[model samples]
Target: MPGKDAHNDTPRRVLDANFPDLALPAAVAARLPALVHCRRLASGRSLFVPGHRPTAFYAVAAGEIEARFTGLDGTVSVIEHVGAPRLFGLAAFAAGQPTEYEAVARGASEVLVIGREAYVLLMDEMPGFARALLAEFARRHDGTLRLLQAARHQSAAERFVLALAQLARERGRAAGDGWLEVTATQAELARLAHLSRQTANELLASAEAAGRVRRGRGHWLWRGDRE
Candidate 1:
């Protein structure tokens, strides 16, 4: 009965010292310790696999998680990265179904797991917390919509420019020499631009050549207005 396997005996994760204080109702926050436990994870650990029955929603209290998708052809897809205080398994917990993606630990991590039933009950009792969670989901949805549009509608150059512009606005620091503090990796920047890694590298080089931007050791600087 692999399909009916149960995870009732799974270990729990609690709030870690490094974890940020989540915006939950006072009552919900008080009861959260009862529902969630703390866990110490090893690097590259698999939290859950796709298609497995999901029993709880996980929050990374002290580290990071990677959301991954596995195709029928065995291709592994890196869907997204989630940092501390972010929630995973919400879809499975919300839909009462298996998780759509696998979650893995990127490094040694402390995580909290709230059982599905407990989460639902807490949400029903704390409408404010539920609203906050819903708002976060909506924000992610909007970002996904924009990513889809960029992938399908925009040229690679347009996507590159747009992504740089958005990052500059969101994470840019003081304008001395116009340096940006964004620390996105090449892979991450490629994902943001909705382009392949090679294409992204080429475009970045092109931007530098045209004096549109300067890639630094740990930051970027807007160098030109070229397109």
Candidate 2:
């Protein structure tokens, strides 16, 4: 279970760090401190499950959240790993629909949640907030299209490489000269690339041989100069 923190006041720096996608004006920003609350989640705890109606928008303040989809047969697939400073559940929340996937904390995490009423108020009164939200939606739309195109036309190895590249760009940290470390297990990479674990392993071996990637225990170091 997620626990609400007693100290729920959202600071300006925290807001700037977590909601970088939203370019809120000073007026809109002034209102957020009162509208947002913080919740802490233990690893493997669910923030929200499928068919649940979203009452708030969430931005990861720390750690990661895994968005997963469960099929009729109960096979679960990882849809996305929403990491710190990223927003999740926006599509369902904005559309007033029940969430189709479960959002679970991947590690001990904290999130800043803005209730629906507050979101609506901002949307209605703040042009900057509305515009920023629309812009983020458009950006996600383009990213989804690219992923679909890659899945349709790219080879398995190509798809795997692309997935790694995307993760490295989005979630990786500088691991010294010319190397970027991405905190992801091979299973997570396989799921993200829509490849079997064995296939991902084989591709990774090949990439390792070619001096493209170095797999660590729970992460991968990508050569920044490599494609």
TM per candidate comes to 0.67, 0.80
State residue 39's C-alpha deviation in candidate 2, in Å. 1.9
* Model 2: lDDT of residue 102: 93
Q: Compare the candidates by lDDT and give the number of the best one.
A: 2
Regions of candidate 1 where Cα sits further than 4 Å from its true position: 1-25, 148-154, 158-180, 191-196, 207-214, 218-227
Task: List model 2 lDDT by residue over 1-227, tens digit each.
Answer: 33334333343455456446555567766676678877899999999999999888888888889887777998776666888777778888888899988999988999878788678767787556677777777876576556556767988987787678767856889988788999888988898787899999999999999998988899989984675
Best by TM-score: 2
lDDT for 108 in candidate 2 is 94
Clashing pairs in 1: 13-37, 13-38, 14-37, 14-38
lDDT tens string, model 1, 102-183? 8888788767777865677566875565666777677665754665577679899887776665555434566566555554
